[model samples]
Every structure is written in structure tokens, then in C-alpha cells.
Target chain A: MRDGRAISIERVSKKFCRSLRRSMIYGLGDVTRNAFGIRSRSEVLRPEEFWAVDDVSLEIERGETVGLIGPNGSGKTTLLRMLNGIFWPDRGEIQVRGRVGALIAVGAGFHPLLTGRENIYINAAILGMSRSDVDRNFDAIVEFADIGDFLDTPVKHYSSGMYVRLGFAVAAYSEPDIMLVDEVLAVGDRGFQVKCFKRMGELREAGTTFVVVSHNMHTVAGFVDWVALLHDGKLERFDNVFDGVQSYSRLFLGDGDETIEKLTSGGQGVEFRDVTVSSQKLKPGGSFSLSMSCESREALEDVEVDIAIYDTRDPDLYHQATNSAFGQRVDLPAGKSSLEVEIGPFQLHGSFAKVAVAIWTRGRKESIFWWRIPLELLEAPHAAGKNLVPTSFRVKAAE
Target chain B: MPPSDESRQSAEVVVYRPDNSLRRGYFSLWGDIVRELVRNRWLTVQLVKRDVGAFYKQSLLGIVWVVLIPLITVGTFVLLRSSGVVAVGTMSAPYPIFAVLGVAVWQLFAQGLVAGASSLAMGGDMLTRINFSKKSLVIAAMGRTIVSFAVLVVLVAACFVFYGFRGYDYTPTLGLALAPLSLIPLLLLTLGLAFYLALLNSIVRDIATMLSVLVTFLMLLTPVLYERPVVSNDAGGIASALSAITEYNPLYYLVSAPRELVLSGQVADVGGYLIASGFSLGVFLVAIFGFHLTETRIAERV
Candidate 1:
């Protein structure tokens, strides 16, 4: 009940039964008990039931935009639905200030046989817009949706992109105090997504609190002021965007050292050990140094080393530095040999990246040893696209 | 308590908690329903417009089905009556006009109950996604029944004109104007049962299928198509027992009151009609209270 708090969720939990028959039976029992004014045992778990959202508490202030990001079945949607009041929590309480416009499913109640102009009113009404509110914003909504020629056509005839555009436009124009947006933004084209983010930015400036659930980190990372990371129906971290994204990336990729043994199988007597980095973290325009020791059973001449860096979000090889590529040569004596590779002042997209080190013979055909190192990326600039490159923008008068 | 800002701020803040049934005060829950229904009145209208428009738009027969259904039923009953296969027993107005009028009023309840019972289940997709007042869907389902009944009223008017042209003593009175008022009790009762059925049907769909059959059987028990018989031993054991059941059936009073007013300009039992209306109002109030209590959990079960 604090001033300026838009939404306060206190230790909320919601459970779902797996078996359909048992779920229905339990629903009947609970409803019957509810009818009699008896409190149902909401705190206890029944058979075939599991908590979909467990002991998650969050306080969202006015005008703050918080992102709910987690993998599939990670309770992000459940938490969003609870905020929207579609599913009341089985335990604890949720207090919401002002009106909530939930874009849980865009075009949710639109009759497919109805035309776009007709459904605009229906969808807006469902989103909690009064009649006059829709009337005032009707033209703006249509202009924002930008499905001009197809506005008179039945929504069933419109493309999926057009349908989503109209739906998002109505909900965005509803002028709610709190907006709950799900992954429905993924349906629209790139231009429409940009328009939506711009509209959301405008709403944020007007002090509309937002709780958005999206798996697209590139989208969520740019827009959200803070991120709540969830894992397996539990809230893992609620922190700034970088910390939460790094934790989410770690969860997604699993422990890095375990994959080293499986990734380096065909080693020829030279084992790469103690692969250490100068710092585990680096900014986009900063460089990091990696050094490793190679133990060889026999002396080898003209050996080569290669270090490949990959963005952890998308594990495609981003950049590689090789001794041969740099016109350098390496010679490894019998026992212990040390090597250093300075890997970048290069730019990357996500908050975490991984580097793989490999040693090759003179022919560059056979590998001597390989190792993987996980790196923490910092201050990666958010942009419209996934690429975060060092660039500058200038504005000048057109002469 | 602060006076001016308290009401406005309290109105703006919404608190959602578990076990709502225990927290709700009796009078406040009633107030909440009225406020919510008033607030979402436009949503109810839109749902009705969407459903009714989509229904007719998709059907090739369109509005003709409204008149055709009662016509076909009346036609079969008239044929049976003419062949001496059935006994209607001393009707005041023409049998065709009488039967069609009964069907029109009876359908308002039957179709409304069926529609309302399935409203939540049919809109399960939207129900789970959005958080609008659930009563809007049930009330909007009743809107379709109103439209269908309005269309059937035209058919009933045609029955009166057709029978009147043949000199069958089918002259109507000013009571026809007040005829729709008699259906208030029937509507309230049907809506009350529909609220209960909708909640149950969302959990176990068998309630809906079972209700359709039960409605058909109840139609036979109520005197919708025939006159109410006195409990006499000479009518046969089953007939007497059915007449006995009809005497206690609330639907008989609800259906016959409006039909008698429309046909003869007076109700045979004014006391029975008043009692039935009062009973329906009580059921409606209690059922709505129960519905409002647990509607928050419906999205999950659905």
C-alpha cells in the first residue's frame, strides 16, 4: 500500500493439476467449497498438482518497465497472467493500482467473421476502453495499425500480421495505467515491432507501468528498465538487465567446464590445461587476454594455435584469431608449454560469450589440444538489430 | 477516513486475493455485480453483436431459421390434432395461434438457458486470456435469445392474422402489449439456472449435454403445447400423475401467465404468477451472488 506503487505482488503462488480429469474434479471440489463460504486448502498441494508459479514477489513502481524473461515453462507467462488477473493466485495477494491493459493474446476476442473496423471496437472494449475513449482514439488507432485498404475486410481474410497490428494498436491506445504485454509482439513485422516499441516508450514517459514477458532478449533488454529472471517456476534473479541476462545465459548454456571434456575428444597427447583469462568480464570496446598451458608427451615443431570466440546467446562462431592467420609460428618442446592469445577489442551482441582454444600442427589439419572458456560480456549496446558494432551517428543540414 | 479522495482512490485500486467468497460481504457483492455489469455493458453489447452477426453471416438460411423452426413444430402438431391423434382439450384461441405463441415464449427461456449454459465453455479461449467481467458473456448469450424471440413475435403476429382472417375468434386485446412483461419471471429464472449451469459446465461438460435433454423433457411436463389438465382418475394413471406434476411446476405458471394474457386478456391465477415472480427474483439474486463469488477462478478451470 505504498504511494507511487503501481503493482505489488506478495509471495504469490499458483498451482496447476496435470491430469485433466483430476483437475476438473479438484476444480469442482474447490468451487463447491467456495460456494459454501469455506476456504479451500490453497496452500497445500493435492495429487497430480504442481506449483506453476511459486513464492514470487515483486513490487513495480509507477512508470517502471520490468521485463519477465525466462525459458519456456519457466512461469513467466503465469506471473504475467496473474498480474492481468486472468488467473488469481492460489496463495497470497496482488494489488494493482489503476486500470490494466493486458495484451495476453492479441486479437483474443475478435470475431473472425467481423470486419476490421467492427472488431476494433470489440477488441478495444475488451481491453477496457470506454466507448468515448475508443471514439476519440479511433482514427489514431486505425492510422497506427496501418491496415488501410483491408480495414473493411473481415479479419479472417486479413494476414496474421495485419490482425496482430490491429490488436496491438487497440490495446496500446487504451491508455491504461499499467500495461501487461506478452510475447504477442513477436508476431508483427520488424517495422510494426519498432512502432510498438516507440508507442510503449511514449507510454512509459507518461508513467504507465509495464510488465512484459518475452523470450526475445534483444527486444526485452532494450526496453525493460529491470529484468526478473525465472527458472523452473521459481524466481532466480531480479536485478538490472545485465545481471539477469548473464544469469539467464548461464542457465541456458549450463556449466561451461563440463562441456570442455566432451568438446575436446581427439587430443593427440597435448592437453590444454589451466586456460585462464586476464579478466572474466569485458566491455564491448575493451580487450581481454587468454593464456593456457599445453602439456605435450613429445616435442613438436611448427605448431599453430587458434582461439575462436562465440556469442553465447547464439553459439555461432563470431570471431577467430589464429597464429597462421596472423603469419606467426609456434614451437612446443616436450613437456610443459605456455601460450597467450589476446582475443579482442571486438564488439558482440549478448551479455555473455564463449571462447574455444585449439592447437594445430604445421599442416593445420590435425589438432593437438582444445579447450573452452566462458566470458562475461559487459556494456553491450542495445540496438534495433542483433549486431552491436562500434559506430557513430551525425546529423547535418542537407546542402 | 478522508472524505474526498478516499472514494476515488479506492475505486481506482483493485485488490485480487484468494478465497474471495469469504471476504465478500453480502450487500457489497451485490453492489459489485451491478457496478461491473454497468461498467461492461458495452462489452456485453459487442459480444452480442459479434455472436449474432457471425451466426447469421455464416448460415445460408439466415433469419429464416428463426421462423421456420416454430413453424415446423406447429405444423406437425396441427397435423396430429386434425387426424385425432392428440387431444389439446378446449383451447380459447385458435390452436395454431395458441401453439405458436407458446413456442415463442417457451423458446425465450429454452434457448437462453442453453446459450448461457455454454457461453463460458464456448468462449474458453477468450476467457482464459482476458479478464473481463464473466457475466457479460452470459448476459450477452441471453441477447441472442432476445433477438430470436423478437423474430418469432412476428411469426406469432402472422398466426393471429392468419387465424383471424378465417374467423376463428383470434381477436387480440391490449393485453398483447403487456404480454412481454409476463415473461420477466421466466427470464429471471432461466438466467439464474443458466448461471449455475455455466459454472458447472465449465468444469464438467456433461452438464450442458444433460441440460438439453432435461429441457426437452421439462417442455413435455410443462403445458407449453397443451392445456393443463385437472387431476382426475378418469384421465388414466399416468395422465393424472403428469397433471399433478404440472400443478407444482413453476414453469407452468411462468409460461401460461403470458400466454393467457396474450390470448384471453386476463390471467387465471394472479396469485400464482406473483409468487412465481417473487421466487424467480430470489433465485436470480442468490445465483448471481454465488456466480460472482467464484468467477475469478473460472479462467484457470476453463
Candidate 2:
């Protein structure tokens, strides 16, 4: 407790009590019955309380950038609010050493009836800025928000994007010792999102401690030094950014496949049976092969079997071909039969997905099978330039 | 590495560390509260200004409504006096003037009580975001009331001129100058009661709705529109008990002090004012203490 660490939470737990009775009966009947001594089982039933945030212990030092990543309802926002002292935990202690700034929900303090200019002052004050401080920073906030004419108009009339921009501008310029950002960067277009991340990077360099919660793995990987993964109101893993992301991706991808399988079985008739990949025996940046097989019970004809290969890093479909275009057809013999397809010379250094399937019949098109087979493309040692796979193999080195 | 290059290399190396300590203490708590309040001063001013501005925002009558409502109330009482429905007492000033002054002072107490009680609950958003002095909330509510009361005072003064009645000679005497001084304790008491009620209303929402009903009945117990002395003189069987009740009534003394100095052109009742001030101060301290005790749990209830 004597060091310059900015935040510390020890054995914190919060519980909320919920009643089982409906509002119509319980709300009105409870008032009347409780006034008298008439006790009923439903009225006297003790409230069932569950801890929303379980025992969580963590320490954040000054000038550290931490990323919070998890699925929705993982108590990330709750923990941020607790750090800001917005909600007190039922048990344990939290100590914050400096001025804490939180943008848990952008535009949370904006009133619909108030004009943007008025709301700036009001919201600034709510964020712990004095009147003089707001006056000094007002121009910069407005400039960053880029809302010139709308500043004097009621915020209710502004578009959702404008609300987010204004909220972000005010919060970013607040310049507190510690800042908590929660999923606000996902708002607006891709360009604005990039600008926000860049600005956050600048702030991170200026000795500001940042606790960011985002589902965007790329942003988390690029920006944060450390990451904490939460699951079902518990901190599942806390580690360096790369390791945390790897663990998260594995958990996320595993869950995603299970959920996708569930959706596909629900009256889609199409299923992904198996998927596999191949590459040149050895050497980095060498050619690679991908293969997928599908089996169907019914015999199919005049089907278009398409294979789409995409680099997971860029998520762009680099190669695509159909069996019809290649003069091939799937004429299965009545019962279940398998179809196999292969591709090669994969020239990427990241994971690639092999999406293959056969499409037949209009309106109620039946999928013979689909597979999301993964392929790892290695970089060739000789590949030097951007988009480095050479058009012709003719090389001479000075000896 | 060269000296300059070594320094440049050191600058690029990022250090990752964690701090785990609490800063400052209770004596500096007030500074933190002040900083939070200053940051949110805009919200406080806006809320206070809105309460004042809404009185004259869009209506054709605008600010006149403030004067007109009390004037109309006095007009109704005047009609009752003219029709002989009620006996008129002989006084140094016109009956309407006396009645209107009583109404003006009563409005201060009522406004202070209602607005102060509802202040924190009304600004629930601010309460959850940052911690500030709860006293500022009461101050904002009182500020709104004071603004309206000041406007009303000017109107009351103008009415006195219109009726060709010379304004009471207000001099800078030790006693006469202390007329405004009497209101301090009363203000404190109202703030305390208001804070207490605001906290209570958060826990028991029904209290807010029931307050208006309670206030209406309480108005009868206070001698605001009519003179308590007149009622005491007329009572036959319960005269002593009725007079005792009227003597001890807090509002009776609250109204009497101002009326004595301003309209009647006499020194204020010093003994009566002091006793009332003491009572108000006592109530204020108790109410504020109760409010602070209950405030920690208000967010959960709200």
C-alpha cells in the first residue's frame, strides 16, 4: 500500500437479491399485506441473492495498459464500474490512488433535453472537471468531436454517431491518471475506429494507465501490454497480451464451432463432415495444399461444388473455383458417397480457411457438405517484397 | 553504445509495473469532494437555473405568474373579508398587505422543504457517477428558492408603491439590520429536514407523494394567512390551550419576526426570534446527521 500502484482490488464480491413474485401481485399486495400482520409464504419467502462479481483480486500499477477480454456478460463493465467507485462491493476492499476516469458507456450522462454545449459542461463536471477546466478544454473537445453547428442543439436531435463522437472527445481529453474504456471504439466507421485506436495509443504513451475492455482481438493484441480474460463473472486467465489472446481465441473458436454445428443441424440439411490441409514437404514460404471431403445420403447431379480459400489474417478470399467451371460433376451413386477436393501453392504466413461445399437446386438449395478446414501458410525464405510470391523463378546472386 | 545512443535506447524501453497503494487521508477528503463538486458545478447551476427559468420560459405571463399567484390568493381572502364571511381585525397595515407578506414568507419555507427533500433523488445520475458533498445538493435547491423569493420581494415592494403606501423606513440599526439574520437558522433547519426526507424518499418512494398531503394539513396548523393572536382572542373554552399552541408554533415566530420589522415598523421580537433560531438549528443538525447516515445505502435502494 506504499507504492505508486494506481488500483488494487482484494477479495471483492457483489450480491444482488431478486424476488420471485411478479410485480402486479407482489408490488401492490406486499404493501397492503405488510402494513398488516397477515403473513403468506410467497410474501415471506426470503430473497434469493447471487454474486454478480465473485472474489476478484488484482493490482494495476501506474502507466500500465491492461486489456479486459471476454464474452458478453463476463463482468468486465461491472469491474470497471467498481474501480470508479460507482458501485460498492458487498465484501472486501478496493483502493484507487489517483483520479480515475471511466467511459464505461459513452454518452451515459447526456440528457436528451440539454444542448450539447450545456451537456459538455454538465458532463465534464460529472466527470470531475471544474468549471474553469471545462472552459479551458471546451474548444479542444468540440474540435475533436467535429460537431460545429450541432453543439447548440439538443443532444436528442443528434445522430447516434454524433453522440458517440462527442462522448469520446470529452472523455479522451479528460486526462485523468487512470482511464477505463469499454467497447466504445467499436462505434462509428472503420476509419473512425482506427483514429480512436491511434489516439488511445498516443494517450498510452503519455504515462496514462488504461484499462480497456474490448472483444476485438486485433485491437487488444496491438494495443495492450497485458490482458485479463473473464468468464461468467470470474477472472479465468490473466497474462501477457499474446498468451491471453491465444487462450481466448482457442476458447472462442471452440465455442463458435459448437454453436455453428448446432445451427447447421437445425433444418439446414448441410453438414461439415471433415477438413484437411497439405503443403510442400519442407521449407518456409513454400507451397501448400488444402483438401475437404463431404458425404451426402441422396444422389446429386448438376451440382456446383465451389472451394473458397481465404487468409485468416486479412480474411480475403485469394482463390476460388467451382467444379462446374473446372468441368467436374458430383454424380453420387444413390447411397452415401464422399467427394474430395484439393488446392495448393498457398503463399501466406498465417492461418487460412478452406470453405468448400456443393450447391444444387434453386430456392431450397441443398448443401452436399461444407467444411471450414484450416491451413497454415508458411513464408518462403526467398520471398522478399510485399506480396512476395514471385511471378517467375529466375534468380542470380552476386558471388 | 555511444552516450547519446545509449540514452535514446533507454528511452524506448517500456517498463511494465503494478502499483498497489491507497492515496491521501480523511483530512483531505473535503478537497476531493470540492474537486468533484467543481467539476459538476455546471450540472448544479443548470438544474438551479432550470428551476428558475422554467418559471418564465415560454408562458405569455412569464415572471408575472410568480407575483400573480400570491396576489390571487390574497384577492380571494379580500373577497371573504368584504362579504363579511370572516371578521376583519384592525391592523396598522391594509389586510391584503399583511396577508400577502405572510404568504411570501410561507412560500420560502414550503419551497425550501419540498425542493431540498427531492434534490438528491432528482439528480440520481450525478450521485452514481462521482462523489461530491451532499450539502451542495441542498444548497442548489435553496438557491432556486432564494432566486424566486427575491423576485417575489421586488414585486411585493412595487405593490406597496402602487397603493400609495410609503415603504417602511429600513434603517441600519443593530436590531433592524438583523432581520435577515433570523432566517439563517431557519434555512439550516429546512435544509436538514429536506436532506433527511430526500434520503427517506429514496428508500420509501411513497413518502414523496404523501408529502404534499402532509404539507396541506400542516399549513392549517401554522398561522400563515391569518393572525394567531386574533384566533386566541376569540376562543371561549379552549382559549388558554389554543394560545399556548399558537405561541409555540415555529411558523408563528418565523412570520412574526419579518412582519414586526417590515410592515409594522417596529423592532423584531428578540427573545422569540432567538428561541425559534435555536429550535431550527437543533432540528438542522439532527436532520443532517440522519441524512449522512442513510446516504450510503441510497444507491442500492434507488
Candidate 3:
């Protein structure tokens, strides 16, 4: 409704000093120069200092939700800090239209010795809320946090979940013009997380601007209008959520890790040349089969073939088997060989999830070959039923 | 109540630009820092309360330590002077009362400096995540010492009454009337040093360790328990050199001037008092300017 954009970042950059002694010495030199009325350029880096965030620029229209997605230490956090004015940019300028409610880290400014109630007030004030503003929203914050009687108890006694919940509640309930959230929702329980998103949804509808930094691609795709992918302190892509996520997935795998290649000189005499999936894009419960080609350099008996599917979203969601479940016996011939494996429908929630296929020799438990395939899951026609392990892997040897 | 349409208009129009010149805003930096601190006044108060509250939260003696630190310090000197182990040659007032007032006044600045210098590092997680002015933390940490100084005020009052009963002439005069005002200069000096020390300590932590040693050594050098050493023809060696240089120690004027005013109802060395106060004011302005420039880089260092 105002005459301008909600946030504008222009060529913003922040430098970090790696060594304590060097940082101190530099600070002293700078301050001493300041004393004698000398001005120096901060854009260039000196020794032991590097740019954490380098020459980044962005702008957000009022009421838009943007997601910042990147790997650890890629400067997403540093960029957010710059946006919030926590870390003043070394070289660039930032213009914010309204107060920033930033949950940079859960309970970042919370004094452990202070009561949960006291912290809410202090944290609110730190976030640019006035005392009376906090007083007005105090009840709602307490209700949303659900701390109950623990409000009077010191936050040091609070469980991590409770601490995060209370912290999130204060920031969300403040209803600032722009809210910068930094992966705080991951700490809460599932129910609280759901509630937080629902609250965020309502806020989005209210024309509140949001810049959410998250590693969860599904959540980002669901919640944000645009996505900005950061790689190694540079913006790789700033586009619609889908394209941005695709770029991020590609970057994730592009770290000198070749996926489509022969692997594992199997001691059991069988080696897998390559594994391929029919399609990288699929709906939940969509039918897709894996095909593999391999060969045995040495003659061997009972060289049972083994295959596995590893989830990229969570490593724990893995499935491995030596025997085919579809009744066809897995046999790798002593010479060049190939197999087309078919199985049940895949109910994977993939969009950004990757499936790494691994082939192995049974009994010897020797890995034959493996490659990770980044999967893109489209929205299901109907909400796929409550299947935690959505994709099931079953293999039958080629005819 | 939720933010009304009226409150929604509080959106500030900001300009994001690259800083090509550090000199561009240096003139307005002072005004900007002051305005920002004023806006965060409530947060400053909250932080001060939290620091003072947490200090004694688990301790058995609790707030008693506020008075106890100065008391124990003054008591040790009093014992030393009375037992002849350390001869403090003086004739101003009763030794216990004279030393306690000086130590109490000195403690206000010393404690504030230590607390304020370490405040940034103490706010470890906060220094990185929150978007408030670091000036508030320095001011608030310095503010926490006021509560302990208030406790010391009560002790000083009791000392005055006890010494007055013994005919030591602890009389209230015009100088005594302005004695509390002397704390203003002392406070300015403490906070000025604190502002620079805190910023420096964030970059190099050796400032904190060095500050502790310096505060103890400086306290011994000042004429707190002992009278101002007379630098005459006969006075030579360590005594004359220390006494002559002690005149330059701002703490000497800040501590000794007000103590002289409160106990003896006299403004001893008024020119020195004015010089020290003016120097402190200069330090405060310089430190504040330096702090403004360095604060932008503080998060990185901290």
C-alpha cells in the first residue's frame, strides 16, 4: 500500500575476520586512523579476512514471500543479518521500509537467567517492538508459545522445544512489516511447526513481507513466491521456486561427484556398469522402474544381484535388498550383461528429494555401482494417503 | 490490539546504497547513534535490569555483594593503616571514612568500566543475531553499576554518621551539597573509557585481561587511602615521581575531588578537577565517534 518496495538490498557485502589477533590489530589500526580523522575503504579485504557475503543485491515488493536456499556456510545467514542490520554491510547499502522481526536463531537474545515472560518482552524490544506494543501482544504470544505456567520460570530450565516455540511465537506475533525467519521452525515439534506455518499463511494473506531461509525444499516450494539460491557466497539463481530448487539440486550434486559411471570392482566377480531411472519427475505413487547394466570379469557362483534406493532428503529413508521381490531371479552373466528391473509404484515426495541407486554383489556384500538421481515430484492429484515411506523399491531381473 | 492501518504507515523509507565514501555520513554518525540509542531506551533498561538481576541470582549473599566489595576493600585498607603494617600518612578525616568514600566513588567508575568493556563479548549470541545498537549494551552494562553505587551510597552515609559521632567533622556544606554532582564527571570518564575498551575488547580480548590488571594497579597509585603525597624539596625517589604523575591520572581528580568535597567540604585542586572533567568529556566524544565507525564491523569481530 505504501509507495515503495518493502526491502531493497544494493550490492551488500560483509567481511569476516578469521584470526582473533589480526582482527584486533586491524580494529585498533582502524580506530586509531579514525582518531586522526582518516577514512578508509572496507570493500577490499586485508589479511585473514574474507567476504562472507559479497556484492549481493535484491529487492522485495510489499507482501511477497521469498525463500533463501543454500548449503551451510554459503552466506544465507550472513545476508539475512545484513538485511536485518545486525551486521552492517562492509560496502553496500540497505533500505528497509518497515521494522524487521528476525528470528535469526532461536532465542538468540534470550537471557538464560530471565524468566520466559521477561525474555518475551526483552526479545520483542530487541526486534523493534515498543513496550506497549509487546504488552498488547503479550497474551497472544504466550498463547501461541503455550508455555503455560513456565512463563514465570527462568528460560534456563526450558527444554529446547519450548525455547524455540516461545521464541518463534514472539517474532510471529509481533507482526512487523517484514519478517526474516532463519530455519527456526525446524526445532519445534511437528504440531508446532504446522501451527507456525498456518500462522505464516495467515500473515502472508495479510500482505506482510517475508524472507524465509530454509533447507527444506518442500516447505520453501509450498510457502514462498520466489526462491533465491545461494552457492559459495554468490547468488546462483533467483527465480520461481521450482527453477530455483532445480538449480540448487544440480549444484548439490555438481561438487565433483559424477553420478552416471561404472563403480565398484566387486570382489564377488560381478560389477555394475551403470543404473538409470526412467523419469526424474513423477507424482506420488506414480509407476517408475529402475534399469541396470553390469558385467562379471571373473566366473563366480551364486552372485546374487543387490540394489538399493537412497533418499536424498533424509539419509535414513533408505531401502536395500539382494533378492528381487518380483519373482524373477537376479543373475549377472560372466560376460557383458544387462537387466531391466520393474517394481511397484513409487509414492515418493520428491520435488527436491534425490534417489541414489546402488548395485551390489550379495553374500560378499560388495558394492558394485551407485549414482544419485535428483527427483522432481509434482503435486499429487489428491493428497496421497499417509505413507511415511512413500516409495518402495522392488526389483525383478530383465527377461 | 493488532497494528491498525494508521500504525502500518510507520514504514520508514530507506535507501540501500553502496558506501563509496566513509566520510559521507561521519558528521551525522553522532546524531544517528544518539537517535538510535534513544529509540532503544526501554531495551537498555531491560538489559541493565537483567545483568544486575543475574549477577546475584544464585549467590548466597546476593545484592549484599554490591556493598560488600567496596566494604571489604576499604576494610582491608583500614586494618592495614591501623595495624601499622602500612602507614598511610594523612590528616584529612578518619581513615576508614576517607578511604571508603574514595573507593566507593572509584568503584563506580572501575566497576562500570569492567562491565561495560566486557558487555559486547558477554552478549556473544546477541552480538551476531540481534539488530539493536551495540551502544545500548555498553550503556546498559555501565548502567548496572549504578545499583551497586546506590548500595555504596548507603554505606558511605553510615560511615559519615559513624565518623561524625567521633568528632571527625563530617559536616555538610555547599561543596557537600554538590558532591553528588561530581559523579557526573566520573561517570562520563568511566563510560568514555568503557566505550573504547568494549569495542577494542571485541576485536582483541586482551583488553579485558589488561583492564583488570590496570584497574588494580591504578587504584593503588591513586591517593585513596593515603593523603595526596606532598612533592616538596625533601620528597624524592618513588614518592615524588608517583605523586607528580598521579596529578595527571583522571581518577585522582574524579575520585579525590568529590571525596574532598563530601567529607572535608572543600574543593581541593579545582583546576585539576576541571581539566580532568574536560578531558573525560573529550574522551567520551572521541570514543563515541570511534564506536560508531567500528560498530558496523563489530559483529564480524565478535
Best by TM-score: 3
Q: What share of the true interface contacts does candidate 3 keep?
A: 0.57
Which one is best on DockQ? 3
Ten contiguous residues with the weakest lDDT in model 3 chain B: B14-23
lDDT of 3 by residue, B137-227 (tens): 8999876688888888888889878877888765478988888898798898889899989988887888898998899888888877787
Better of 1 and 2 by lDDT: 1
lDDT of 2 at A8: 79
Q: Kindly report which residue stretches of model 2 are placed more than 4 angstroms away from their true locations once superposed.
A: A20-46, A105-115, A150-157, A188-195, A246-329, A332-399, B1-62, B84-90, B130-134, B165-177, B229-245, B265-269
Model 1 Cα shift for residue A81 (angstroms): 1.4
Docking class of 1: acceptable
True contacts kept of each: 0.70, 0.08, 0.57
Q: Estimate each model's TM-score.
A: 0.84, 0.72, 0.85
What value does the lDDT take at residue B189 in candidate 3?
Answer: 84
State the fnat of candidate 1 relative to the true structure.
0.70
lDDT of 3 by residue, A1-399 (tens): 235478877777778789877777887776666555666466779989988887788878878899999889999998898788766677777888877778666677788888998899888877778898888889989999999999999999999889989988888887777889888767688889889988888787777789999987777878888888887788755666777876676564443322433344344566555656787666666755677666777644444555555455456655566555545555566787777765336655433454545555557566665555555554443232123255458999999
After superposing candidate 1, which stretches have Cα over 4 Å from the reference? A236-239, A255-399, B1-11, B233-237
RMSD of each: 5.6, 9.1, 6.1
In angstroms, give how far residue B123 of model 1 lies from its true place: 1.2
Q: Distance (Å) between predicted and true CA of B4, model 1?
A: 18
